[model samples]
Target: MTSLTASESATLERAADAPMLAQVEQWAAVNSGTGNLAGLRTVAGLLADAFAALPGEVRLVAPDSVENVDAAGHVKTIQRGDHLHLRVRPEAPVQLLLTGHMDTVFAADHPFQSLRWLEDGVLNGPGTADMKAGISVILAALGALEASPFAARVGYDVMINSDEETGSHASAALIAELAQGKTAALTYEPALPDGTLAGARPGSGNFSILIHGRSAHAGRNPEEGRNALIAAADLALRLNALKSAELKVNPAKIDGGGPNNVVPDQAILRVNMRPSTPDAMAAAETALRDAVAAVSHEHDVHCHLHGNFNRPPKPLDPAATRLFELVRDCGAALGLPPIGWNATGGVCDGNNIAACGIPVVDTMGPRGGAIHSSDEFLIVDSLAERAQLSALTMMRIAERGTV
Candidate 1:
């Protein structure tokens, strides 16, 4: 059903012929979790070598330093793995940004380490669907693009970051930098199990609230101490109550409480907030401040809040809508069923790209299901299917000059 010129068909056939399954199997074997520095470095090298075949200047960019609050209520610098970046034909008139993450939720020592054959054509493994396949798809599509006749007229930047699972704090700046002056962006986060794309994404904010109180002996001077643990627990409850129709709050963990005989002197509360829109994000922040003030006053303690909403809400504006339409048309041209999208609460690098005023279609990867769990898998055949879709979409964009 996909009608194309002689040159277009040849280029796309090459893309579909890539050894994507082999590539994904190899990449998924390595544990490149956000906290796995050594593994990440190895995967980054492999990706760099693979991307080098795409007519570009390939390099590994060091991640920006990020900070975090430890369970001891002390701020510490967090080290992250480097990202693989490739810029091709920057001087070309049409520029685009393509992004993917090399990190997964599984740690280096996580038990979900080996790939297993769940059934024919379904391989269960960590990062198989949640993204190793996505990275392979990017390479296949770009490789085809380089071989196409329209290659000289189009340019694109490819970024495979190493810290997406834990929120991509280290690579956020790099994502923004690459998004500037691009016609549109395509992020390789996996499509839904049924192959539907993810449209608008909720903004995510993480916070570490520290509670300081006077420590006093239990029985002897219990009344003299302002229990920090109590205050932290109360704050968590108050934060949860702030959730609305457009905002969801989750108080994930609380750290720092010891020696039952002594009143706790300090405690740290970690919470997550997701807002569906920019206005919702702002309102959530204001409500958070108010809740913190009330808790601090009631418990007679000093409260210090750190962190802000890093990933802003990605709503479908006019430009984003146009990009989605183009992708849908490309899918139609590829003989794929009707392409549609729905908003999801999960966040990814696409949120960061959308914040830069660029149109982005995230979830342009192979169809799969149950990511982040040992059951994660890639719908083996979709690898080539999605690559052809992406290749055709880029070809159209290059020919049309815009989304």
Candidate 2:
């Protein structure tokens, strides 16, 4: 029921709009958060059905059983996989791959598992804004293309993956596997409220530093105690100093400490760093190690650092710039407002695909705000518009052959 301006029609995939919205509402009702195997399977079944109805052959990649440790050190393997090679045409080589994550940040026990109409046109739900809506956009746009002559040449692979919210640990290999040799990829993630898509994203890494120090009673034997907390504070200050204009280093959380009266024997500092480039990431790594060494030696405390960068930066290469310009032209053709974007500090699956050398538009979903929060909601009417833009871009690529 979201009303749109007259110009909005040109930007929307009118053919598949209604059905896609229905499908999104349906999928959103099913809680397929990354950890929910049963829900993921159920949603995958529906995805299989939809893909089967598409123009080309449909193949469901069997769900993968993956074991991982939780924050509490509990062991469990999540069920995951993808709907693969979901589309192919007779015209040219496959030029694009469409990827989405069926899993959301919400869990099965989360209270926001169900969907509801928040206003005249706005719908509120756990996954609706973040991605179920984006999935619908992907399917509906592809469905529109399938009914057109563009279907003959614009071959595409649609991968609805599991476990994207958890850094794509279980499916990173699959993402890389499918990205190989593709000209471009479009990922289904919510767009900015003004409908700006993602451009460059920083390479992110997580770090944990454990500080060990001697323990002794404060009053009885103060000289014998090597307070680790002091060393950890020094380390935190050094880390905070690493936040330059090009990179960000955050000492987010701290754990493992002792009573006030007794000298603290242990302290653990958890920090995250986001570097603008791979070299910046390396420099940050060196700085981190140096900070630990300096603080440890200066305070006579033992320290350990662990963890690594899971996703590299998605810089704006020439190919990506061309792809972005092409998308802008497609949007203009659809009569939408000028499409522009800037680099973001956040990271997404697009980084993973780009690392595999695939040009991608990761934030291709409907314009929305407040993702991963209770306030999240999509611009209900923008759904079809964004889908149309994607469909048109693919068609242009088909007509012109690799822009």
Candidate 3:
């Protein structure tokens, strides 16, 4: 483990706890759900202002156009809020990428707003842990890094996207672009309450299959009409049956059923899949396509499949393992608890970065739990602790000239 210099230790010690919690409270109060474009724009403006304090050029880049298939089998374009991009010291010897998201799972109408103290050190609110606190940690760490003597040796790009909660469809291109040419990356996704991190992650995909059939009166000419709903149900069962040790399949929802008097002409099946390896991911995709084709042929219905596995599996390769070791050493040097990591079924922006062949420690954020629910909470003390950890990790990397 690399030891911290006097100047570096003093800089890390200055990570203020009160200011971090205050920033979390302020940012959590706003509802910036993925679908809430207005709220996301407001939050983006606020984050841009906050990150601007660092020495960088900040810009709000418009999100790319994304398409979604509705229940009626119609494709519609989705509008996502602008994302914030900041670049500092691009010409430095070491280039790093820092990423976070401004969006949460709670919609604008959700009642999970406002902060409350669940205990002396636990603060509960929406986006407080899932990553508003993580963002604050990133800001604090970067602020400290900028104040250090080795600041000029490290160049970094900050990407706080607006569509991460909904699969990062709009900001995916930008993510790939920013990840290019960076030596390493840090994504401020909250750690578990016990400070355990997510190591390798499975590849995930969401598919919406729209089936079209002929509609007829149920009592009159039912035999002449094809039922799309039945086909969709059969497909759902088939997908569920595909689950095994290597792949996880979930038939989440079905849409497009009509009154009991008539045979439904259109139906949609929404499914999610997580494959543990690249080969497993390929097999899953092929199995889904083949199943859909068979169902369509057997039921004599036209089927359209939308969406693909955008996040590929993130294996614990040598580079990623080395980066995790660096984080572990840095955490220990800061007097924090031992950092442990395990494979997770969850996928995040870090998966994309890893796909670019760049090593990333995704969960370098504050300790928190119950993310994506109304009970989401953040551990108050983890704010400064994680900031010091990240700051020290970055400083070490900058000093060594590699991850």
Cα error of candidate 3 at position 360, Å:
0.9
Q: Which ten residues in a row are the worst by lDDT in model 3?
A: 10-19
TM-score of each: 0.98, 0.86, 0.98
True-structure RMSD for candidate 1: 1.2
The predicted structure with the larger lDDT, 1 or 2, is 1
The residue pairs found clashing in candidate 2 are 64-80, 66-77, 67-77
Can you give the lDDT of residue 5 in candidate 2?
Answer: 32
Q: Which one wins by lDDT: 2 or 3?
A: 3
Show the lowest summed lDDT stretch of 10 residues, model 1: 1-10
The RMSD of every model to the true structure, in order and in angstroms, is: 1.2, 4.5, 1.2
Which residue pairs in model 1 clash with each other? none
Task: List where candidate 1 sits over 4 angstroms from the true fold.
Answer: none
Error of 2 at 124 (Å): 1.5
Error of 3 at 175 (Å): 0.4
What are the per-residue Cα lDDT tens digits for candidate 3 across 1-403? 6467798788798665427888888888999999998899888888988988899899999999999998677899999999999999999999999999999999999988889999999999999998999999989999998888879999999999999988999999999999999989999999999999999999899999999999999999998889999999999999999999989999999998889999999999999999998999999999999999999999999999999998988998999999999999888887788999999989999998998999999999899998988889999889999999988889889999998
Candidate ranking under lDDT, highest first, comes to 1, 3, 2
- Per-residue lDDT for 1-403 in model 1, tens only? 3477788889889999998999999999999999999999989988988887888799999999999999988899999999999999999999999999999999988999999998998889999998999999999999999899999999999999999998989999999999999999999999987789999999999999999998999889999999999999999999898888899999999997789899998999999999999999999999999989998899999999999999999999999999999888888877888899999999999999999999999999999999999889889989999999899989989999999
